[model samples]
Target chain A: MLAMSASDESARSPGVLIVDDDAGIRENIADLLSTEDYRVYSAADADEALHVLEAEDIDLLVTDFQMPGRNGVELIEAARKANHLVPAILMTAYLYVYEQLDADRRKDITLLRKPFDADEILREIAARLGDGNAPKR
Target chain B: MTIPPAAGPKAPPSAGADSKPPGNRRTLFGATILIWAVTAGLGILFSVFAVAIGLQAATFDVMRWLLALAIEAPLAAGIIALIWYSRNMHSATAAGEAGAQALAHSEAKYRELIASAPDGIFVLDPQAKVIDVNGAGEELFGLSRAEIVGHSFMEFVPPERLESARSYLADRLKGLRATELYEATFAAADLKPLHVQLRSQVVRPSDAEPYVVYIVRDVTAQREALRNLVETERWASMGRLASFVAHEINTPLTNISLLTASISRRVSDPEIQERLKKIAAQGRIAANITGELLKFARPGAISPIETELTDLIRAAVEQTDAFRKPGVELRDETGTRSVVCTVDPMRIQEVFVNLLKNAYEATPRGRVRIRLQDLGSLVAVSISDTGSGIPPEIQSRLFEAFFTTKKKGEGTGLGLAISRNFVASHGGDITLTSEPGKGSTFTVVLPKQAPGVRATE
Candidate 1:
């Protein structure tokens, strides 16, 4: 579902795409960002998430580090190769899974542990967005 | 004859003097001593007679008198030497008898000790054949002493272990190894398999054959008990792992709370509203799963500090609210005032949650009340439910693990047992009071200040 943005379609709010195998978590992230009046995109897996990235003008990418196939890290790298630089946040239950990310790839990418509060998620997305089409607090 | 090994593989010099010699050399020595003694005695008697004859026959000549004096002095010395030799011979005979008696006494005592030993004792000769066995050994094989002796030890060892058992006995008897310890199955006289532990030691008796002395113990009962203890611990650990596969539960729970909160706010239509309630219901189920895991967990690492338990009690009540039957009231009678106690806040919360959950489970839609009190040194927390009370007979065994009044799939039956353990570990106790059809109350009494000796980091 396209989480309805509060503003008009002509100046669509900056888009944040959330990709996770879990429907509840994917929809909840979308649900959380929708309150900020930003257009939110939800995808069930990496294939679907990549499809959304291709179709939308996604400004921020939020993805779970572990998925059924081709985890969030691989998805973001693939997404970045196709087009422009999109800042990413990777949520994982295991922190050690991302410890080996090279110095170059670590830049503009944030690691978040799971079972996190929704407020924290909003803060990170806004920080990554800076003032450029940043969602309302 | 038994020669004590303390003498270093040789006969004592004093003992040899009294022992009978092996060959004609002994006869020669005896004859020589007799001849010398007799010659000395006869010389004494002849010297006396010669001295008398010389005195009677001699005139007052100086030469004759001198000769008579010399003869008399030599005879007196010979007689004195003979008397000393006779006294030595009598004492040697007495010493020999004493040594023989002492050897007899020690051998008898050793035999008695082996016969009365608790563990089966068997003496095996160099060929691994049983030379002798004690009374216990006979009982161990379920055979008479005559039947057990002169039998190869390999006959009693089960076929599967025969090779190892053979080599072990061979090594011990050859003195290649001083001792051998092993567990093996023994085929008793009735052909029943028995688990026996053998401790075999090499005993080399002086100048005699070496023997392997085995101390055998029937360890079947002991092994069974040890196996049961290990299995019980494994079952207990596996029991806790049931659905709270932590990470699996957490992701869904995180989604549950956030998505349900969002849906309930945005949607206003009755149809969507009904679906949102269902979302809340699933969310509550996830929350219950987390609470149940904590309720059964050892509260993780223990962190005890002085804190108000009232807050903890209220939090636990809130945690269990989702699981309570609809319309069942969990009234926390604890006032807002701090009921201070030194304890692991997490553990106390777990105990409270477990008790409240039990109360909620029993009372489908009735009232469950929690009351806390500070009686100077002791703090008492009581949970009472208006559900059907437990029977008098079953209530006594309520705290035992795997003993549950709840139907099979409903309970692991370990919750109360673990809760009671936690309470008791903190120098506290959980007491139960119940009447059939009148509901039940479980009271947990803890010291206001738990004496501190242990803490886990």
Candidate 2:
């Protein structure tokens, strides 16, 4: 009897699933996106995130690189095989290692570093959501 | 007191164009005989003329007068000629003897120089075989003079280094190559390894054949001492790098704490409020790691206080009279801003004073510059002097406790040692670069982030 009318009529409310090992980070992201009126979901790790992706539709995947097992890139690939074309935005503390990823994946996925200002990641999310004309910086 | 020049002694016969030594005796004999015959003939002619004139002449004995003139006149001339020849021969012998004595004294002194030297000295022929060795050489190789002389110099070189040693020597013998110095390992008579510093020279004496002089100093202890010093400096440099890494991480940690706390203030949702608190806690955890790294880089001793680095340097420059004098410029090139750092102000000011005084003393009229700049992650404060630099031999020992080049009563030698301790306590390092006659630069590289800010009023 939890709210199921979320995806029924609101085409404007895009669903996003944030995944990280730190529950606090995932909660903060979900809370921030929820305030923006997007339908936000979160998971503690990749395993749990995959479960959420299979059950419900999510428009975007925001995942952290370092995790206990099955890091962000692997989780994204696994979700893609399940017929989920969830465009991803990767978050990492290490940019150098991230740059060495497959060229196609690097070109498609958006990268975000931690300790960014509140406006920065929000703008990236808005831009990916097809909200036209947000400052890239 | 003017001593009178004595009346001349008997003059020796001049060995000029006329007075040849070989002809002197024969020519004098010829002249005596000729003069005697002419005088005797004249005396007889006079006596006969008197008897012929039929005058009653006084008693005139021609035979007696002729005999007396022949005996006395030629004998006097012969004695003078003999005396002149002997005197010239005596002077020639004395001069030759004196010259020989001086040459012997010089040669003895040279031999003594080699014999008494602390290092091995070898004289080698053009073939690179040893022609001679001094007493030290014999002791160094554990060989007698006979065994070492005439042996190939390469024989004493350690087997591992023989080829390179041979090539180094070969380069020197290729003409006009008189001086070359190198380090090599040599094997003693007992096959023990001996580290040596060798210098070669090709000397050409006018009357003697040319030879190479190989001066070898057994430098095993010196090399070990130098290695220990290098190792110590390397560890110190690594410590400095670690502090820089800690500082770079620290800047981001600050952003994390500030941003997360700011987010917490704007948000009121209960679930998110819990999350924001966790983020702030996690930032503190990250900061703790940086703190541990900083403590590892520099041990905790003195409590550091926040102070503007430029102000400290300026105050130090003003305190020392030498820095205030005319014609000498003490420039604070750290720019116009206050770059804040956590340090012991009094201790740091003392460090600045020491560095400034050193620079001023070294430079009589040129520039003594102090520069503070951010080197990406680290803050560097440097004092440079356009002065006669510390020689390389002394540079390594500049930070050693009680090591000073200043005169007695002018320095206690503890200034640099204490300064290094204070800087090290604050996760910083002091380093020196000196080129003799050019100048010296003393730089202190420090971290911008303290372990945790305790900026006191």
Candidate 3:
């Protein structure tokens, strides 16, 4: 299932995709991003996330590494295959999995180990999406 | 002479019918009586002859009769003496036969006792060659009596232990050792090492050379049991500590980080925001540590399933491949053969990944090798690295929680401790063999059947 939150100025705001198997985390991130004046799209698993990716124009991808069908890495790879050069953040409780990523794959991806707060996630998002002030085309 | 009967009523009842004189004594008495009668008859005949001659015969006839009677008496006494000598010889032969039967019976009883004893018994000649072995010895050595006898006892001892074994034997033989107990490793017929306790003594027979008798008890299982107990206790205490940290400290740390973030977002002052951020950052660090602790604490969540061991190991090797340095070579020696076991795949996979990652991290410019072996009742996976091996002092504490040789941010030190707990929950164990300057090998052995499941033949 998809949960979309668009502000009145969402047509000009950057769109962000949040994919996680956890409903609480996905909705919380969506709420945070929406309040920061970005349009938010959320999915509970890789399959739902894939549907949103095909249907929406997302400026950034924030995904969890461990999920039901495909992991965050595979989802990111799928997005890249579809010519979406959107920057991505991979959050995981398993740090070893992040260390196993090749240098090339790791270069474009930011890692957030679990139990992270809103500030860290917001900081990483701002770093990728340019302070969340101007909307990306 | 006449044979005298034994006094019937005066004889001890314990002697019973045997108290009577034997037939040989009666025959000797009869012979004596006949010989004396003949001697008397002959004397009478001689006297009559003298009287018939009628010339001053009275005195001379009497003297001649007396001489003849003396000669007859000596012959009769000699016959009796011969019969008595033969009777004594017969009795002595009967007694010797009874003694031989008793000795044979006693030897058979001792042989049975030795054969049935649970501990291995070895009778070694002074040269240390096995002259005799009991049934238990045969089972312990995994060899038959024919295969063991005449072989040097030293042959079963491992090469490194031969000196100590020889020393012990020599001391016992020379009576220099005050105690009869010693312990050592012995290689069985299959070349498997056995930990054994030996109680031995030297036996010197008057008619034969001195020999050593060893009573060997296999203590391999007992030693393993003791090591397992110590290991289990260590992990259990570590787990308790992890549980305490996760339960008591984790919730507060999380609240501190979340509340600080919430407050920082609302506050407009830059100074307050910066300080709150710092507090949040420290909370995150503490939370990270607690997160690892939770993983170590919660091993009972294992969901065991039938999984192929080689495939699991392969996945781990692949996962850790990215950690390999430029000049480090990773070798997968796990063959294509499928070795299936009941295990929690996620937990076991984590164990493999942890070990492999450590190997790759340690070997910056050498080789990292992983191999799988199917040991009938169990399976072993070994991860070896050609890196600077762990030192003796650090090796003992390698599996301790929060004990790390790595620089601060590189490790939390819970990887090995958690991995060991995971493997142990599966009724398996992890062992390390390392040489200071050479390298290290970590072996994880898992039972084919899960801990609570009954094993099938």
The CA root-mean-square deviation of candidate 1, after full C-alpha superposition on the true structure, stands at 14.5
What is the two-chain DockQ of model 1? Answer: 0.23
Candidate 2: segments with Cα more than 4 A from true spot:
A1-11, A132-137, B1-457
Better of 2 and 3 by DockQ: 3
**Model 3 TM-score, 2 decimals:** 0.50
Q: Least lDDT summed over 10 consecutive residues: which range in candidate 3 chain B?
A: B1-10
Error of 1 at A108 (Å): 22
**Tens digits of lDDT, candidate 1, B334-365:** 98878899987767788898889889989877
Interface RMSD of each: 5.4, 10.2, 6.3
Better structure of 2 and 3 per lDDT: 3
lDDT of 3 by residue, B288-348 (tens): 7777776876544455789998888888878887898999988889999889999989889
Q: How would you order the candidates by lDDT, starting with the best? A: 3, 1, 2
DockQ of 3: 0.11
Q: CA lDDT of each candidate?
A: 0.73, 0.69, 0.77
Clashing pairs in 3: none
- Per-residue lDDT of model 1, residues A30-57, tens digit only: 8777777688888877888888887878
lDDT of 2 by residue, B185-254 (tens): 7788888777888887666544445566788889988988999999778757755785677656754664
True contacts kept of each: 0.49, 0.02, 0.20
Which candidate comes out best when scored by DockQ?
1
